[model samples]
Target chain A: MQPRLVRLTVWAAVLGLAACKPKEAPAPPRPDPADAAQRAAAAFVHCVEGGNAACIRTGLPHGAFDAFVLLGWLATGSPVAILDALSRELVAHSDPRTVQGRFVREVERLSGPLRGAECSPVGAQELAPMVTQLAQATKARLEAIGMASADMMRVVEGLAAEAAEGLEGAFLVRMSCKREPYQLYLAMVPEGPRYSAIGLMPYLPRFLGGDEAQIDAAQALRSKSLGISGAAAPVPDGTVDRYLPIPMEEF
Target chain B: MFASFASFLLAVSVGLSSGAPDPQARATAAGYEQLRGFATVLVTHLNRALGTEHLPPFVGAPVTPGLIVTADPSRVQLFDRFAVPLSAGRVSPPEPSPECASKCPKILFDTFRRWWFELGVESRTHAVEVPDVVLIGAHRDLPAQTLTQIAYAASESRPIQPPRLMLLTHGGPAGVRGIPFYLVRPGGLTLPPNSAALGLTVTIEPGRFVVTAAARSFGRTLSATSVPELVAILKDVHRHHPNKAAIVYRFSGDVSVGNFVATYAAVREEFPVAVLGDDEPITIP
Candidate 1:
């Protein structure tokens, strides 16, 4: 009986040893760098195309403004191809009387000389006179309205600031008037980053109806939406349709 | 045999007790609770507007209540079909006009803004505000004397050498408009313009100097600096301006690289500076 008990104890010991031994963990599948990169790129493209704000927030590198701009373009349907085509077309046939013309003239002056001489060369002597005339005309128009010189100066300074940045390359002149609404399109350029800003676009309601009150209201809304001063007020629920209103007013 | 059964029961109890709440589940629950509260408020408002009977208090939080309205067209259609008839007597269904089409949207937007403001205030009360830094970059080379004057005026500790300079310039002969140039110095030095190249340089003192130039013009006369040396210079700058909140500079229009540099600067506890155009002084945090 003692011998039988010893054999049972030995069998128990062997079982315990077997249980205690570490099992080999399945080797982790090696990550494919190419696949990972492809996934990342796909996610980025999807976020840009889908215009899903949550997906954009998740896919973008944190605090990246480029991602924000790209998302904004996607949301507005102002992709790179559209923006570039618009810019080139505007540049080609822009008449000086229109807002696009004024911007094109300004860009031409600032950029020194475009490689192709599609238009007559603006001489150094003519440049200052033209700028002075434009400035004077702008001042007169502002005076005709209630806007103070300070406000006009602020607008001019803001536009100049934007031009100094590389934004001129990416954005096309949409429309701008001294007292009217200003709009710029982010042209779809094949190279580099692109974004469009419809500055004072929401306020076009005022220009449409000639209602100063509506314009003021729209301006306030634009400022809050753009988060110009600080953090933009969060988009209110059920107000998405307000951004793209049917144009009722004629130029 | 009874004791062995009791021991097994005890072991199962212990195993069950050891399980912890899943963090993801907890977060989802919290999110759902917030969504439910928002939905309740929204539904309550709609009910009041429609003069419908109030809904009973929900037993538990609702998940994706909007989905219910979307998935069930009949529910939304019922509201839409009834809205005109219900309001027809009290509020005359005004003739559709182009003006109304434009103005109606604004009224809706105003309501949304009000709701958003209330939500934001509520969130803010619960949210923890964290300190953050903003970094600005500029291609223009700043004068050492100007920096010294500002440093003296501010009464901040001055470093022995100038901070490493980062220059943004056009990339090459191809004339790529926006390319960033990074220059580093182990010991700080003032930047001086490269007379022969399309760059600016400043000499802080003997053996201390800083230079910025365009990439197309970055050969022969222009001296190159290492990345480690630039990091060391930044570290020295951090040492001197220990108390300042942010460091702002002008970016060369390269947001990605610029943000990275800004983050690096912020990590050192210096506030990133907003780079305004020429003549605008770098706003020290």
Candidate 2:
């Protein structure tokens, strides 16, 4: 009887050990911040490549408007086929608070309709607080995404700031020169778009008679009158010619 | 006890081997490996070409350098062509130039205007006639009409814009074209503008349905008409492939024109331009 009882106990032990074989551990939980950042970046790249800016707002995190602005600059190359894809992805995941703040900040920076004189001052005043909130949200999202240390992100942001400033100066100059027949020539330079103060035909008497100093002064007044003080002066003809000669024959 | 131990061992072996992922998964993994190998080869070739040291061979075969003159003098006309004015504040004005700037007699502002209009018409006709392939070239001083003609050709018929590959034979102001142009240095030698004259060797194989451009003489400046003329000649060759095509162009005195003739003979046998996206064989409907 004692031997039989021992055998039974051994069988029970074996059964228990077989039952205890561990099941595969559940897939590790995704890190929320990393996942969100990756998704946002992927969605943004996709939309910009597809050439659909309108679709990018949806996939953005609750406060990441700056990322959307960055997308616009990066989407300039090639056919920009990915923009449409990104827009669809962003819009499907709409949480306005996630992206609105950054959007407004970027608009202000890009001189997007929000900052122009053509926009009513009353409307601007009303939207100021909302814009501020958007900026803060964007900053928070950037921090969350760990974009603070990214060199590429910083360069993109810097370029955006420069473009915004340039656009503002250009707008001012255009307003001041509105009465002149001089037409604006906006050249899309590699870094950003540049506006020539106004171009007049070389054969025209006024243009041919004017000395270099006179031409420079007119451009300066246009800049000052538009309240664009710190803008870079018009590039010298020699330099401009080397870099982008007026394809005069192929206008 | 022995029977139970054997059963347990058998079950573990079965799970380790037969219970592994399906054959389809294994095949997919193999397919991915092959894809990776092909990608590696492509990337390696591209890197070699772009590297700072030795220049890689041209992507396609070489062909005889050629030229075309629109013998039809009646086709020439003139109209307002777009031009960037000299004054800084001026808008681009409509200047008149020759319609056939490439083939027409050189004239000042008036004759040039008429030449531009003719060129625009020719460019449009080329696009319509050869919907599959159109090659264009512009001299350092491309007339405004030539640029507009290229733009017009690029805009016609394709839902999406077709790719434009460009090779700069001269350094000058950027000219407008329907397609994006790349600047290539010939003989792997990079030289500054005004230091060299250049010519492009193009071949079109209509039977094979392919077009190829080879960078021929370096350090030479070709006229704006040279590239368009070369393209027209290639199109003509495509029309008479598996037979013979004639090339006609005057060369600048600076370079050995004979070298171009020999190089084209050697290169023409290899490069042929085919329909876009038809690099591989397919059965025509």
Q: Which has the greatest DockQ?
A: 2
lDDT of 2 by residue, B64-92 (tens): 11111010111211111122222221113
TM-score of each: 0.17, 0.21
lDDT of 1 by residue, B1-285 (tens): 323322432443233223323437635763222221223322332333321121111121122212110001011111111111212111123232222211222222232232222222222211211101001111122222222211111111111111112212222332212111122111122222321212222112222223232223323222214434544554554464343322222223222222333233333333222111112221111
In candidate 1, stretches whose alpha carbon ends up further than 4 angstroms from where it belongs are: A1-251, B1-227, B253-279, B282-285
What is each candidate's fraction of native interface contacts (fnat)? Answer: 0.00, 0.00
lDDT of 1 at B72: 14
**Interface RMSD of predicted model 2:** 23.8
Residue B60, candidate 1: alpha-carbon lDDT = 14
Best by TM-score: 2
In angstroms, how far off is A130's CA in candidate 1? 50
N/CA/C clash count, model 2: 72
- Candidate 1, which CAPRI tier? incorrect
Which lDDT values do the candidates have, in the order given? 0.25, 0.26
Give the lowest summed-lDDT range of ten residues in model 2 chain A: A119-128
